[model samples]
Target: MTGSIVFDPLIPWPAIAALAVLALAGVVLALWRGLSGWALRGLAALVLLGALAGPAYQVEDRTPLTDIVVMLEDESASQALSDRPDQMTEAAEALAVEIGARANTELRRVTVPDGAGDAGTELMTALTAALAEEPRARIAGIIALSDGQVHDIERAPDLPAPMHLLLTGREDDWDRRLIVRNAPAFAIIGEPVTLTLRIEDSGAVPATGATAPLEISVDGGEAQSFDVPIGQDIDLPLTLPHGGRNVIQFTVPEAEGELTDRNNTALIQMNGVRDRLRVLLVSGEPHPGGRTWRNLLKSDSSVDLVHFTILRPPEKQDGVPVGELSLIAFPTRELFLEKIDDFDLIIFDRYKRRGILPAIYLDNVANYVDKGGAVLIAAGPDFASADSIYRSPLARILPAEPSARVIEDKYRPSVTDLGERHPVTSDLGDGETWGSWLRQIDVTAGAGSVLMSGVEDRPLLILDRVEEGRVALLASDHAWLWNRGYEGGGPQLELLRRLAHWMMKEPELEEEALWAEATGQTMRIIRRSLSEEIGPVTVMRPDGVTLEIELEEVSPGRFEALYDGPEIGLYRLAEGEHEAVIGLGPAAPREFEQTIATGEVLDPVLATMRGGVVRLEDGLPDLRDVREGRPAAGRGWIGLTPRDAYETRDVTQSPLLPAWLVLLLASVLIVGGWLREGRR
Candidate 1:
């Protein structure tokens, strides 16, 4: 309760003051003339003036409210490292007991978790939210139990009293991190692409050499290690081995006494693209179907086609001079032996064994296929004759053997059961309604899968793998009839494109493959195979936990499953002999980017609030009372200010003097003065 004096004047204050002045002057004149009633007159005038000035006593009844102290507990991912979590838990319990013991104080504990996505630690965001919930006038102070690695420090709220930080880590904590400063999303295959990287050490790092051993791997292959200088930018030039998504991982061995190995490794995924595709098209003679093959390869701007046509063989006797023959000599030796490996795919369009290319050159072509080269055979009726190329050394790599017979009946190509599962022909429109072909060479598939058949179910197309290379045989010369819109043109363009890419070993066209696509933390695992039945996929998480996930066949031979990963890191997937590695989120989470604890991030705000930092490793500080605007942290103790906030419950006011009593006192004094003057 509190009390104070207040006034409510019965008349204007100026009028009362004027009457008092005139009465005081009359009394002074009477006293100067030796009047006996001068004192009594002064007493009467004072009494009348006091009645005009209304005076009252006012009192208030108030209830003391508790002061709010906001305590933010940092529970982010980084805080889980080492012994920081234990330290935080202990400090929180101690602070809670101390705040409860203090008079008129309450604790608002806010547990801050890891931020959404890659936002990292959001201590300030949580603090600001907690502060907004309580009254600013009753706030005593703010405290945070953290590693000082806050991500949203700019959002720190305005402090009503003081703010103190209880740091969680030891002074000797340190960490090493691998940083990929610059990397390209797409790099041209077989060309050197430069990537920028740096290795750094933070916190109280020990004395060590200036270089560290770094290991690098592509597509999860065997890693190669090299000594690299620390704290300097490194430009690494790499040439991708295949055209597709290439996963490159860089890791450094964990050093002794380091905080974590999470930031010591980085994963980079880049797409490998081809600058241009080199193709060699060899035609035996000028024919209608030959132009179709030429046009198909020429349509793509990325394909460089080198076409050669044997207009006249060595056996053809011509009576024309070499200069006037309008024929350039074919560079058979340069193309077949010198630069054969330079071509991505070699097409034989109705090409038969001729004296133009010797038997040794054909033998070299077979060797090229054994060493990761690709070949396509588009046969004509000549493939069944004595001059067929199947009779030469090239027959060793061919997928099918010619039977010296040609079917002249018109037949529409049909996809076999195997073809329906093959990537090249699986999604090509319904094969039953395609245009018919005029003729096909009879052949027996020896060591390959027959994808398509025609004319009494004989093999029409066969694909095979020979050593490290791939080969395809389409035993028909009249496919050009379909391209000419006969019987409503078929999917000639799409079929040929898929066939070519498959022969060149495109990753997406592989017979067996395992990969994953990620949208946020959810991953879609895909498995592609030609077999009718497949085993369950075995998934290995980032923390070495393994689980088997059964896949559902969404389409013919394509299996898939969706998994929502609990953590962000590299994931390893395998089904049978096929395996793949993919990253669900960032290679290095933001929490691990700065593992060592320090108060620099929140120092500026703490200083403005007249607070200081206390390391928990030095022992949890004892809580104490401090004056507002004074330092709230010291060597062995932290402090919270006393708010002394209160709420008014009731108010009362009473007049100090009654009006009747004042009038009676004035009349008595006036009469006494009059009687004294009459006696004088």
Candidate 2:
């Protein structure tokens, strides 16, 4: 119970102040004039004002509630290393028991976990949230059981009571972490990209050698080791071996006496893009389909096109001089022989053997395709003739052989059964109606799956692989009808784009591939194949745990599965012969970035509240009651501020004097003052 004086005046406070000032002035003037009644007059004025300014006794009936002690337990990944988890558990349980047994005290245990993605441990975030639940005035102190490697210290809230951080690691704790300070997200294939990295050592530095053994590997292959200097930035130059997502893993051999080897390894995922795609377009003569190919290739700013049209054959004998017929001859030697390997893709549009390119040049083109190059053939009615290029050496790699027959009937193209499961032709089945073609060469499908067929189920489009390169054959030259938007048109642009990218070996357009991409903690697994159904995918986690998950057919050629990542590390995905590796969070997760514990982060905050910083490894400290603004810590014990806060169940206030008593006092004082002044 507590009591205080409270005011409930009959008049406003401003008016009362003014009236008191006037009464004081009049008494001072009377005293200075040698008036004998000044003392009585002053006493009378004070009495009258006191009656008007009502004073009451306010009493509060409070039931003392328990003081709150917040115990923040760090359950983040770093805390689980070595014996820290056990240490924290032991200390927390002991603290809970001790706090619960204390008189008028309560314990609030808040478990702090890893933040979203690479945000690390948010100890202050947990503390703020815990504070919000309990009354600020009632919080006696905040006790946290953590490694003290908090990431968001700036978010610490304004604490009302002492905050004590009980450290959770030993003095001998040490750790090593690999940091990738700078890396490009997209790097051009075949071009060297520089990555900046450093090896950071925390806690007690071991007496190891100056140089550490670092290893580098691409796409989960065998690693190559090198000696790199510790505690210094090193620029690593790397060239992507292929297009699309390239997973590069870098690791350093774990040292003895370190906390854990989790930070010694890091995963880097970067995209391999093309600086410029070189395409060679050879046209037998000016035709509408040739224009369509030109337009499609030119649409992409990344493509560098080198087109050549054979306007006149060498065999044609015109009665004109060579200089009059042409100003510059086509550089066949420069393009087809010397720099053939420089091109990524080569297209022959309705081209036949016109003696424009020698037989040796044709052989070189076939060899080019054999040595990891792309080629496409668009045959016309002339392909079935005697002078067809199919009779040349290039026929060895072409997928289809044209018979001596030409189908001149109007036919609409349709995707084959196998095409439905191939990425290049998979999306062609968006249910859009394609225009009709008037001319198509009758061909016999030899090697490769027929993706599309024209009239009477004959092969229209066939794709195959020759050596290390890719080949595609289209049996019609009137595909430009779709580009002209005839009969509502079809996905001519889209189909052509897919075919071109597939020939270039784009990973997304591959018919068979296994890949995984992660967002937050969930990984989207994609499996593409030409088979009707894909088998189960074998997933290898960073902890060497293998999981077999069955994939569901999301579309014709695509199978998808969403798996929540168990932790942040490199995840390996394998489906039969296809394999892929993806990094989940950062190379070294934020939780593992700093594993050693210290009190340098929150020491200032603890000092501001006059709190203690103790280590659980030394044993849970004894809790003691201390006054606010005093040192709440000793050598083997910590202290808490006993707020003695409670809820006021009842409140009563009464005027010190009753209304009649106040009136009687005021009348006597005024009468006494008037009679004394009249005598003076």
Top candidate on TM-score is: 2
* Candidate 2: tens digits of C-alpha lDDT, residues 1-680: 88999888889989889989999998999889887777777777777677678888999998889898888999988899989989998888888888989998888889899887678899998899888888898999889888898999999999989888899889888888789988899999999999998988888887887789899999888999999999999999999998999999999888998999988888888999999999999999899999999999999999999999888777778788876865478899999999999999999999989888989999999999999999999899778999898999998999888888999998888898888888877767554467787888999998998998889999999999999999999999988898888887788888889999999998888888889878977899999888877789999988899999999988887899999988777888888889888888767777887788988988978888888788887877888889988989999889999998888988899888777876777677667777877886
* Candidate 1 residue-wise lDDT, 1-680, digit = tens: 99999888899999989998999899999999998988988998887787778888989899999999989999999999899999999999998998988888999999999999889999888987887788899998888999999999888778787888999988998899999999999999989999999999998999978999999998778999999999999999989887888889999999999998989989888989899999999999999999999999999999999999888987887787778986778899999999998989999999988788899988888888999999999999889999999999999999899999999998999888988888888888877678998798999999888888989999998999999988899999888888999998788878888989998888899878999998878999999888999999999998899999999989887999999898876788999999998878787789999999999999999998788899988887887889987778888987888889999999899877678887788889889988999997
* Predicted structure 2, TM vs. truth: 0.93
Model 1 scores a TM of 0.82
The most accurate candidate by lDDT is 1
Error of 1 at 492 (Å): 2.4
C-alpha lDDT of residue 495 in model 1: 81
lDDT of 2: 0.88
Cα error, residue 279 of model 1, in Å, equals 1.0
RMSD of 2: 2.6
